[model samples]
Target: MNTKLIAALSVLLVAPAMSATSLDLGYKAYTSDTRDDNAGAYNQPFLKLSHFNKADWGTLFAYVKLENPGEVKDAQHGADGKLTVKSLAIVDKQIGSSNHNLWMQNFLVSNRTVMEDNLYLGLTTNQKFGDLFINAGAGINYSAASFSPTNASFDGLSGAAAVINARYPFALAGLKHSLTVNYEGQFGRDGEHKQTLGYDSYGHQLITTLKTNLTKSVYTKLHLTQFDSWGATPNDGIEYGIAIGMSF
Candidate 1:
C-alpha cells in the first residue's frame, strides 16, 4: 500500500466542516463456482472501506478493498490475500448544462498481479422519467503492466467500456427503499484477451441491487451479480452479498 497517498487522501477528506464528506465500512462474503473447474467452489470474505468528499469540481470517492479467496479442494493453494485501492471523481453537479449529467475520472491499483492497476476517464449522465432513474456512460481504460490481468497479452493494454444503470425508489415502513439494475460491457484488445481466457472477449456484467434505509442515516444493501463469459475466462460465475452502511 502507498502510505503517503493514503495519508494525502485522508487529509483531503477531513479538511473542514464545509467540505461535505462521508465514510463507509462494510464486509461481504461470496462464493464462486468457477473455482476448481466447477468441482467445488471458491469462497471469499472481503473488507471494504469507502470515503467520499464533495468538492467544487465534483465529488471524490476513495475506496480500499481487501479479500482472500480459497478453493474447496485446496484452500491453502489460493490462500493469498489481495488488497486494492480505487479512486473516482465525478464532475460537479453545478458545472453541466441540461444536456449532460456527469463526467468522471477513475484509477485503480492492487497489490496482486492478477488484479492489475488501471486509469479511466469517462462521461456519465443520469436522468429521471417519472419514478424511474436511468444512467449511462462510456470510458477508456489504460491497464498498467504491474497490475494487468495475466491474459492481457501485452503491456499497457488499452480498452473501453460502456455502462447503463437504472433505479426505482419506493417508500416502505415510512422509509426509502430502492431497486437498482446495472450493466457494463468491455470492448477492445484487453477484452479480446479476456475472451481467449474463456471470458467474453467483449466482457459484460449484469448486476442488481436492493437497498433500504434502516434509519435516517443508516442503510442496508443486497447485491446479486451475473457474469457473461463467452468461453474466455476460467472463473466466470455468480456472486451475491449484503452490506450495511451509514451516510453523514
Candidate 2:
C-alpha cells in the first residue's frame, strides 16, 4: 500500500477513539485522462475520513482526503492529486420540519504544484417531494496556484470564483441513486492569470452515483465523474472516471 493510503487508514482507525460525535470512513479509486495539457492524466486511489460534531449553532466538520501515493505517474495540472485537508462549519435549519436551509464555510489546503489552497463559502437549499430529493447551492471560492521554478510560463496565480452546484437523488430498483452537477466561473483575478475566465473556466464537474446497502454499517457505491475542466480552462477535454467505493 502507498504511504499516503496507510496514513489515511491510520487516521480513520484512530478517529473513532477520539470521542467523535459521528465518524465516517470511505475508500475509493478514480481514473481519468482529462486535462488542458493532457500530459497529467492520472489514476488515483484515495481514502477519506469525515468527523462531525454538534456545535452551538449547528455542526462542526473536519475532512481529510489522501490521494496519489508517493508521486504516481501522470498526476498534476491543478488536480491536487495529493494530500488535502478541509475544515468547515455548517448550520442547517428546517422550515416547518420539512424544507431545509444550509450555510457553510470551509478552507482547504493541498501540497500541489499547480494549485495549493482554496477557500469556500456556500449556502444550499434542500427539499424532498415524494420520493425525490433535490439540493442547490452557490458559493464563492478563492484558490491559489503555484508553478515550478525551472520552466515558468506564468508566475503563481490566485483568483476568486463563483461556484454553483445542484444534486438530485432518487431511488432506483430499491437502490439509492443521485446525480450532481457543479459549475465554477472566475470573474476576478488575484494574480497575473487573468486568462482564466469564461464558462467552465473554473470547473465543470458532473457525477452520477448509485449506493447499495450491504449491511447496517456497510454500503457499496459506484460513481462516475466527468471533470470538464481540470485546469479550469476550455478545450481541456473532459476527464471522466468511474469509482467504486465502500463506506462505513
Candidate 3:
C-alpha cells in the first residue's frame, strides 16, 4: 500500500458522486399570529409548492405560492383578491467549486384585492463563495385596481414596478440551509393612455426569509416584510409573518 495508490483510490471513490444528481418535491408554509393591545389578535398564512431536478447544465426548478386571509383583504369583506399566487423557473449550476443559480419568479397578486391583478417579474443570479452566497437581480411590476363601496372603477389606471434579490446557503446538521433577502419596487402610472397616479411614485418592501428541510418530503420557512411609500393620501406600512409546510 503506497501513498500514490491510496490517492488514486480516493478519487475513484468520490467520482461516482460527481455524476449523480438529485430531484425532490416538497411543500412549505408560513403562518403568523399577532396580538395588538388596541385591537384583537390577527393571523395570516401562506403555502408554497416546489420542484427541483438536476441536469447536465444545471438544476431546473418550479415553485408556486399563495397567500390567504391576509390582513387588509379581510377588512375588505372578501370582495378583493384574497389569494396571491406566484410562479417561478430557473437554472442552477455550480461554478469554480461554488454553486451559482440564475432564477426568476412572477408574483401574480396585489395588496389591494380589487385591483385587476398584478405581476412582479424578478430575475437574479447568485454565486456561492464558501459559506456565503451573493446574488443580485432586476424586476418589473404592473397592476391596476378596481374599488367601489358600491361599484367602483379603477380599470382605467395601471402601474409598473421593479425588484431585486440576494441569498446565501450552506450546511447544517449535514443538511442544506439558506438565508434569503429580497427587495421589490414598483413604478406607478396609468396604463395605455392615462395620467400618472398623481405624478407620484410608490415602491414597497424589504423582506427576509430563512429556509431548511424538515424531512425528505417536508420543508420549512420563516419570513418578514415591510412596505414604505412617499407623500400623502398615506399609502404605506410595515408587517411581520411566519409559516411552515410539507412538499410533494
Candidate 4:
C-alpha cells in the first residue's frame, strides 16, 4: 500500500474506537469464486473487516479486505495478499422545508492490484417502504491510476455514477434474517474513453447478500454478485461466496 492509502486506512480503523457507541464492527471469512476471463477462475479466501456508524449528522460505512491472506507471493488470482479498502459516507442536509432525507454522499475505493482509486460524489435520498430501507444517489465519478506503470489514459472524469443500497429485515424460523442489495454503475463515457478502458461505455456491479443471525452477535451470509462490463478490464461474470461473521 502507498503512504497516503495507509494513512487513510489508519484513520478508518481508529475512528470506531473513538466512538464505540455509534459504531458497529464485524469480521468475516469468505471464499469466492472468480469467473473473469482474464483473471481466470479461482477460489480465494478473504478476511474482511467491516465498520458502520450512524451519527446525528449522517452515516459512515467502510470495509477492508485481505485477499489471499495466506499467500505472500503468487497467490490465487494473483492477489498477492493485497488489501482492498472501500468507504462510503453520507452527510445529512436539508433543502428549504424538506425533511432531513436529502444528503450528500461520497464513496472511495482503492485497490493495489489494479493500482486504481475511484471516487464518487453526489446527492442522495433515504426512503423506507414497510420493512425495507433504501438509499439511492447519482453523481459524477473520477477514476485514476494510483501509481506508476498503470495506464492513466482513462483517468480523470471517468463518467456518470449511480449507487443504490437497499435492505429488508425479517424473522424466519425464529431467526433474524436480512436481505441486502447494492448496486454501483458507471456510464456516459466518451468513445475514446471506452476504447481506452477496453470496456463498454457503461458498466455495473450488483451484489445481493442474504444474512441470517445465528446468535446475538454471530451471523452467516450468502453472497451473489453480477459483474457486467465492470472492472479495470471490464470483466463480466457471476461470483458467489459464503461467509461467517460476528458483529459487535
Candidate 5:
C-alpha cells in the first residue's frame, strides 16, 4: 500500500477509540457528463466509508471510496484499481487570548489508479456568517507521486494549495436540507512540470452539494462540480450527479 493510504487507514482504525467518534457507510451512484483528458467520461457508482472524530485537541475525518466496483478497466479506476483514501486532521490552537477558530490542519489524499499521492499542511480558520459556516485554509502541498516510476505521476513540491468550504442549512416544507460548497486549488508550480503533467500551473476544483434527508438515516444528494484540472490530465468540465445514502 502507498504511504498515503496507510496513514489514512491508521487514523481510521484509531479514531473510533477516541471520544465522540461517528462512523458512516454509504453508496453513491452518479453519472458525470464531464470528460477526462485521458479517461474520457466516467459514470460508475462508488461506495464510501467515512469516519469523524472530535476531541478537545482537534478533529479528524477520514474516508475510503471504492469506485467502479468489480470493473477492471473502468475509466475512473485509481492506484489500488478502484480504491481512494483521504484523511484530514485539524489541531486546535488558540492564536490569541480569544481566537478559538484558528487551527493547524493536515490533509492527505491518495489514489493509485489516478497516480496521485499528496499531502498538505497549513493553517485554517472557521467562521460563521449569519447562518452560513465557512472554513478556509492555505498551505504547502507535496506530492509523493512525483517520485513514482509511472510516467504521468505528479511529482515533487507541487505547489501551494488553498481550500475553502462553506455550508448553509435550512428547513423547507418541514424537511431539513443543507448546501455545501468546497473549493481546492494548487498554484505556483513550475511551468515545465505543468506541461509534463499535462495540466495548468493552477489546477482546481469547485464542488457544490445539496443534501436532503428522506428519513432519519436516509438522505439524497445532488452534486455539481467544476474541474479545472486534476492529476495528469487537464480537465475543464462541469460534472453533475444525484445520489442516495443512509447514515448511521
Candidate 6:
C-alpha cells in the first residue's frame, strides 16, 4: 500500500477535485490631500482577503486599516486611526514565459515607530509587456520631523523605489471588468550632512493608480500622490479610494 503512499493518496484525492475559487471578504475607502494651507486631510479604509492555491506556489493576503478626516500639520491630534497587517506571495510561473513576479515581506506593520521601519520590503512586482501588467519593487523607509519634538534618533529612510504597472480586462460569460495603472518613484540617503531637521527631511515620491475588477472576486480603487523633498520643497498629495475586495 506504499507506492509513495499510493501516489500520496491519489494526489489528495484529485486535489479538491480541481480547485480554484475566489471571494473571502473586502471593503475599502480612501481620501487624501496635503495641499498645505489646509494641511493634509486624509481618510483611508481597507480590508482584504486571498486564499486560493492550485500548485500556484503561494497567496495569502490579509489587511485592516482605517484613517479618516485625520489631520496634523504641526503634529499630534488624538487617535486618528490606521491599522494594518499584510502577507503575500503570488508567483505563477515564468523564467520561461515572462510572467515575472516576486513579493517578500518582513515588517511593514505601521502607525509610527519614530517613523516606521523595523526592517522592510513589503511591496514588490515585476512584469513588462502586455498581458497588461508591469511591475517594480522597493522598501526600507523611516522618518521623523513634523514640528520638532526632538525625536531625531535619525536613520531617516528610503534608498530605493521603482514602479510601473498596467492591467486590462473585459469578460462576459463569467463576468469581469479589470483595469489598472501605476507609476512610482523614490530614492534617498536621508538626514543632513550636518544637523538641521527641517523636513524634505529627504524625499521624492510620485504615485498614480486606478483599479476595477468585478468578478474573479471584486475590486475598486483610485489614487494619486506627489512629493519632492530635501527642503527644496514641493509637497503635493491627493487620494480618493474605493475597495470591494476579495480574491482567491
Better of 1 and 3 by lDDT: 1
**Which pairs clash inside model 5?**
78-112, 78-113, 79-112, 79-113, 146-155
Query: Residue 170 in model 5: shift from native, Å?
Result: 0.4
TM-score of 4: 0.74
Per-residue lDDT over 48-93 for candidate 1, one digit per residue giving the tens place of the 0 to 100 score: 5565566443445555555442311223355544443444433323
lDDT of 5 at 170: 98
**Model with the higher lDDT, candidate 2 or 6:** 2
* Alpha carbon lDDT of each predicted model: 0.55, 0.45, 0.45, 0.61, 0.62, 0.40
Let me know the TM-score candidate 5 reaches against the reference structure: 0.74
TM-score, per-candidate, Cα-based: 0.68, 0.58, 0.53, 0.74, 0.74, 0.27
- Tens digit of per-residue lDDT, candidate 5, span 168-213: 9999989999999999888986565575556777988899999898
Candidate 2's TM-score reads 0.58
Superposed Cα deviation of residue 62, candidate 5 (Å): 1.7
Q: What digit string (tens of lDDT, one per residue) describes model 2 on residues 53-101?
A: 4432333445665555454433555444554343333333333444444
For residue 167, model 4's alpha carbon misses the true position, in angstroms, by: 0.6
Model 2, runs deviating above 4 Å: 1-36, 52-62, 72-102, 107-109, 150-202, 230-248
lDDT string, candidate 6, 113-220, tens digits:
222222233455555465565555565543323323454444445355445556665565565565555554445545441133334434444545455666555555
lDDT of 5: 0.62
* lDDT of candidate 3 at residue 100, scale 0 to 100: 42
Question: Tens digits of per-residue lDDT for model 3 on 129-175?
Answer: 67665655444444434433323434332455554556787678977
Ranking by TM-score: 5, 4, 1, 2, 3, 6
Off by over 4 Å in 5: 1-33, 36-40, 72-113, 146-154, 191-196
Q: Cα RMSD (Å) between model 5 and the true structure?
A: 4.9
